[model samples]
Target: MPAVAPTLPDDLREDPRYYLRHFQFVLDWVAAHHDSLLAESEWKFIVGFGELPEVSQALLVRMVSRKGELFRLSRLDYAEIGDSDRALVPLVEAGMVIRDPLIGLDELFAQLRVPELRQCFAERLAAHGIAKSATRQRLLDVIQEYEEAGDAEPQRRRLSHWWTETTDQLVQLTVMPVCDRLRLMFFGNLHQTWSDFVLAELGLVRYQQVDLGELSHAFQCRGDVDLYLALHDLRGRLDEGESIEALLTEIPPPAQDNPWLAERRARLLYRLGQQAQRDGDIPLALHCYGLAGPGEARIRRLRLLERQGEYAEAHRLALEAQASPCGEAEQQGLERLLPRLARKLELPRPELPPTRQPRARVLELPADHLVICGSVELAVRDAISHSDRPAWYVENGLITGLFGLLCWEVVFAPLPGAFFHPFQHGPADLRRDDFVARRRRLFDTALARLDDGSYRDVILDHRQRCAGLANPFVHWELLEPELLSLALDCIPAMDLRCMFQRLLLDPAVNRSGLPDLVQFLPGERPSYRLIEVKAPGDRLQDNQRRWLDWLGRHHISVEVWHVEWRHD
Candidate 1:
């Protein structure tokens, strides 16, 4: 059975307390669909929260949506919730908020302004022979030194103890961790916050609605949720400059069942390895890269080995990667690495495959040409454009936009772990390895329109229907009606099919590296040619070179135009 969708109020702006309503909606939705996944404590909190007063709920929601877990009562004044003190009473009684909790010195420094600090620590500052007008950092340092040097216990105190004059209390929301778990379940990631609801309510951002089934949960089991939370914590620690060795030990082993979780784990390991390498911990970097999942990790490990003078191991890994590379980037890296490794070991030099060089031409334009056009690519486009053939500086936008429109349904299909939330720009697994394999039939059906004459109409209808909708591939701002129509008329469906097939092969990598501009030759038999622009001393990147080579093999007209400033 499909899960019942949350019915939002028709006019959110009419209600000043809309955020409270949105929070209630999420709780009800999670309780209905994901009750089995919730812990006993979480279930209790959810049930108890529903029984709280409206103002209390609003206050709690506000805290959860705010930046920090601890908030000063004076700072939390909201006209919508009549009196924060009254709202906080019910929250404190319900054990959802901690009042006057012990806070560290660092947190105290953050909570109080410099004037407040001076007022509170005036006697201590004078006794320590520090000036009253000292900066906040200087004051904190002197106080910390005095506290550490003395026998008094570490300076942990309640807000009242820090500032006795004011009655303002500091309260910490105890349910923030639980709320974060619920949020992760709803959004499948922590990056999206409560602001998404507000943005959607105000019609600032839009999303495609997909019907979610009873089984359409982001996590399959409790272990998946736990692993995800662990990873989230580890990433936070990593960002805070936590010890790499300690974090490495804390990362959970790769999940064998969930590819999504495993991929995240691999990415974390890759990041940790990069940090370790930058820190000059060669052995740790090698250890991390060796254990990481398939991708640049293997190539990174090879590079580290070669650098450490382990030529034999590097050569073996290079050969293994040569047999089946992770992606074009790694393959390109290996092509350069193998010959060097062979020479280092004094072995037979490996003969690398011949690479295709893009067809190049030079144009010496006046220096003012760039100033007038605002960019080298635009200047070159204007230089070569003719009445018969029009050009636009659409690097990767046009082709990707067309592909997105043509395959809208397939991309947004209601698959497990893909469309769990309403605020998603695209499917969660759009860049995953099995993204295409999971919906092979749907993609094939969508692509079949190209073979027939139905592709043009289908794409046009989608462009009309889904205009302004957020999509990962579609650059809606770039897809003007006339440009889209011209593309539909000029670019052959076979060529689109080829480009889309390449995109499906690896969406993460292939989505980029397209030509900087495209020129359309409109006529009875409309045709187009892709152009890549380069300024003086600028050269094509490996990805761009790969695209040019692939386009040439497919008989697509592409050129590399190098621009040089004219001296005369």
Candidate 2:
């Protein structure tokens, strides 16, 4: 007979449909009774863990207690763990043994410390045609074979599933709740955001310590937690309308000694300096940044120095920083700062073109160009469909539709490491280089198609595919083969290619702001006009201006049709 599962308390048990909710319940119980459940020694170990040396902490976090009461670790994983056997002594003395049986990967590898045994395992793994790249799988396969050869040890059964089971299944057999164990297992670890959530859930760390930003790792030192908390206190005081002078007297600067803390120290000081500068205390702002070491802090200091009329110091600093090995963005910041500093220092600046006055160009509506004046976008689209010239009225679909047809593979499969992240699941960084790199292959395909005269076929295929797909950018009925063929023949290949390249360079800005409507003329030679309709009070946005500028530069025929309401 199958054994019955043990019953849990009503508070602990959850409905079958909401089984995953039980993890939250189990976490709540462990948190409530943590002090009572663990012995005094274990409690001390958990709370005082951060005080240990960073290397020791790194080792413990990499280890996970297996279902068989043994901790699983791999020699290959040690480089990232950043520790040696000496680091394990303290945990071992505390009765937290990291071990497995003879057939286990860690234990077997330990015994394999004997030269002969190492050669035997390597030979066996290799005899099975396993390359060095498949080392982990090879080890597991050899271990299984050894187990089957009459090694009747009871703990051997757990070894079979140890290397292959899910984390949740492995944690289910452990004494502690998965969440509590995970917190202890990953405390103060960098590179993964899950550890941040675990610490935050236990209330041991604040959310701001692990806040997502342009930089990958947020917390770099033990003192970072303290700095985050202190900043919170100062912000609270400021929100209550406290004076900057009064708050400055109340909070002391953070005293962090670890060299790893340099970046965090610099960032926090820069932020405080910004706050002080806004409060009209320029000296205090400079002082805060002075204590923080260089990197980005120097840039902030340069800006503040310029504001204080210290042109000589700012110019000298900018020149010094420009000579250093800096990232693309920091170099660009220094470039922009140097020009402003030059003008302030009474130095000659580069001569620029004559400033052209920006004006709204009025155009007489052509008989072929159709305008539908509706209070809303949807109403305008509906009205245009009923006109003489066949028109597909849209907000920002035309250019993107053209792009999707030209580069279908890239539109679907974004480049690895550029957009899709295994952990974060959000687009990692949409910077220009990353955006261009991810779509380079697609751009090449577009170029090849243009050269081979096969672009018409590609456009036709994409139009068909876009019609079947429920994509927002593509309206199938509007992108009929006849319409796409006309566009292919009428638009110059080089002009279209340049425009698309500009669009890919800054996708977030250029993807939108396309002309609102694409209307095709009723001629055998496929002629078309793009009209951007604006209601009376509506002006063009910056992105719209950029699109119009690119069109004007290429001498493409585009019109801005401004519409006004007429009352009887």
Candidate 2: segments with Cα more than 4 A from true spot: 1-349, 353-386, 390-392, 411-416, 419-432, 438-442, 459-494, 532-539, 561-568
The sequence of per-residue lDDT tens digits that candidate 2 reaches over residues 524-555 is 66566677777657887756766776676666
Pairs of colliding residues, candidate 1:
none
lDDT of 1 at 193: 93
Q: What is the C-alpha RMSD of each candidate to the true structure, in Å?
A: 2.3, 23.6
* CA error at residue 126 for candidate 1, angstroms: 4.7
Question: Relative to the unseen true structure, what is the C-alpha lDDT of residue 300 in candidate 1, on a scale of 0 to 100?
Answer: 90
RMSD of 2: 23.6
lDDT of 1 by residue, 463-525 (tens): 999998888899988999988988998999889988888888887678899999999999988
Computed on alpha carbons, the lDDT of every model, listed in order, comes to 0.88, 0.52
- Provide the clashing-pair count of each candidate structure: 0, 0
RMSD of 1: 2.3
Q: Which residue runs does candidate 1 get wrong by more than 4 Å?
A: 1-5, 124-134, 151-153, 349-353, 368-374, 385-387, 566-568
